[model samples]
Target: MGSAVSLRRFPSPEERPAALRVCRLPGVYAPQADTRLLVAQVRHEALWPGVRSLDLCTGTGIVAVAAALRGARATAVDVSRAAVAASRLNALLHGCRIRVLRGDLDGPVGRERFDLVTVNPPYVPSQDARAPSRGARRSWDAGRDGRLLLDRICVRAPGLLTPSGVLLLVQSSLSGVAATLDALGRGGLRTRVVERRTEPFGPVMSARAEWFAALGLIAPGAWTEELVVIRACRS
Candidate 1:
């Protein structure tokens, strides 16, 4: 597999590939650095024509579509209606047969096993104890310390994978990479940091900088954060 690609910035419109372009309505999360970063790692996986793949928290369904294009039988799940619509729309636009479902994480898939599972779930720390149930903020806001979805995934992902399955997950450093490693380790999966990229604070992170520092989530006066893609496998 290729080494982790360092993230820089979102590509300009003209630079984006025509095949992967998507239509996003307001309240739906647009594909960003995290999405592209995850997609890059997805390309590195050994996906055969009929491999079963699942993408949780699929916003625009870009990751699922990518897997489908590679000939994997891909399924995507999301809780938000808008996100579900956007995911289905993108799948149709790409002419990929993706089973897009409207439900939270693995709940929608139920007892199904997959060879590969990918997720870019909400990981941003929010003062609110629970992520917003309704709004665009639902795409990125996790409860205090930002582990709400991350923690659940670490616990649940192992069960969702087949015996030899692999999982690719992306999240920010502010969300506690070590905690994730430990959780997945306890879950019996061998894990590694496959990719790491430092990105400047975006609007949300910028606005929460002071609060983050106060809560000791970030160093005082720090404005940059690292995003990491973690690969876990059940051998």
Candidate 2:
């Protein structure tokens, strides 16, 4: 494992592949640790020309662009129009031909299957039972237990994959890593945690620390969370 790459500013082309020049649009989820972690796993995959890939909840479409750079024909989907636009802009900026769609997780893709599916959805435990319809918070506010989207992805991902397809997903430990694995396993996919990273709480988590602690989601004074990348395969 290497040091986490900060997304405070877009990385220079010299720092990363030109295709990864992702822009952080307002109200769109920025590429952060989880995004980089998932992209790293994307680079490790055996991608080739015509390898179809899909990225769900693709905020800035960084993951889709990463797959495209590796010769995978990528499609990105997001419920937010801003996210769809950002994904398209980033793909165009990198000259990567990615199909960007505005829809809920895995919804726009319909019955279309792919060789690979990647996701970095909202997994933060929130007081609200329903996710926000708009604003930056919409990018990470998962309902109560934070499994709102994660659970749906687990159930839907298996059907989205090719016979030998793979799914790479990232989420925080607070969101129940074992539950995700179990859900994917129940869906008939073999799953494993391929990467684990401990990071300090960001603004959102920090703001809700007390409430999370009250709910016993974290230790009273704990201010950090583990991010894990789980890989599920249809082998």
Using all chains and alpha carbons, the TM-scores for the candidates as numbered come to 0.92, 0.93
Residues 1-235 of candidate 1: C-alpha lDDT, one tens digit per residue: 2223222233432355443667676677778878888988888899899999999999888889889989999999999887788778777877889998999889988999999999999999999998898988899999998999999999999999999999999999999999999999999999999999899999999999999999887899999999999999977
Q: Per-prediction count of colliding residue pairs?
A: 0, 0
- Please give, for residues 109-193, the per-residue lDDT of candidate 2 as tens digits: 8999999999999999998999898888899999999999999999999999999999999999999999999999999999999
Q: Candidate 2, 142: how far from true, in Å? A: 0.5
Q: What lDDT does each candidate get?
A: 0.88, 0.88
Candidate 2: which stretches are off by over 4 Å?
Answer: 1-19
Root mean square deviation (Cα) for candidate 2: 4.8
Model 1: weakest 10-residue lDDT segment is: 1-10
Off by over 4 Å in 1: 1-19
